[model samples]
Target: MMGNFHIVSNNPMVAEKYPDLTEFEKDSKVKDIFAEGRNSIHLGANLINHPLAGSIKPNQSPYKSLVMSNEKGELDMFSLKLIEGALQVLKKFPPRGIEYDEQTLEDFQVIDLDLLDSAIDSLPYEYHE
Candidate 1:
């Protein structure tokens, strides 16, 4: 039943009649997708940092206490930047509406990925760690 309608059609009347989705919702959707992307990248990061991970004490899995001595550290910097960029994207395209609903996700699609990608790419390749 949900898929019965022409959601993305150019029909002016249909678009006019349908409930409008907000920019905030659209931004939220992008953030959700970006988060998923960040997670996937983190998995890759974990693999890439396997050697460093191995060095950590077995009792300490997630390094919350990693003290960066005068040197730069090898951490989840890439993932951090990805999330930051994603947040910035949402801010740049803040939801035009005050709130969101289930239908909002269905009503929107990613219009741009360049901004988020650039943020992620801007992070340094390696740190002093």
Candidate 2:
């Protein structure tokens, strides 16, 4: 059986904190976690943009949809460890915009919400029809 581990978050903190989980996977601890039967782990700024990535809101759902699997896929202890490791890295960094382009305002959205609205409104009026 083959499976994959993915970490997706709109939070730019991910990019800033742990730029690459693949690099961390090289660590003995990370390797041991995925020893079970996982294929790969990835980190991204937007989960919704990825083909395999989806968003899960705790209150909106019965369970946390943080992880996903193929029809026959599942996450094991190793997967949890991988998430933990990534989270630890995020905690260390603490989303302070330390790194250039790390979690920029654009990631969250422009400073002015109305600017976005104006841009959207400015789009070809014919499209509305």
Give the per-residue lDDT digits (tens) of candidate 1, residues 56-123.
Answer: 22122111111111222354665457455644644565345435353442232111222222322343
Tens digits of per-residue lDDT for model 2 on 3-28? 23222223233323434421222223
- Residue 3's lDDT in candidate 2: 24
lDDT for model 2? 0.29
Instruction: Give residue 20's lDDT in candidate 1 (0 to 100).
Output: 40
- Give me the runs in candidate 2 sitting further than 4 Å from their true place: 1-67, 72-75, 98-129
Give the TM-score (vs. native) of candidate 2: 0.25
lDDT of 2 at 67: 24
C-alpha lDDT of all candidate models, in order: 0.30, 0.29
TM-score to true structure, per model: 0.27, 0.25
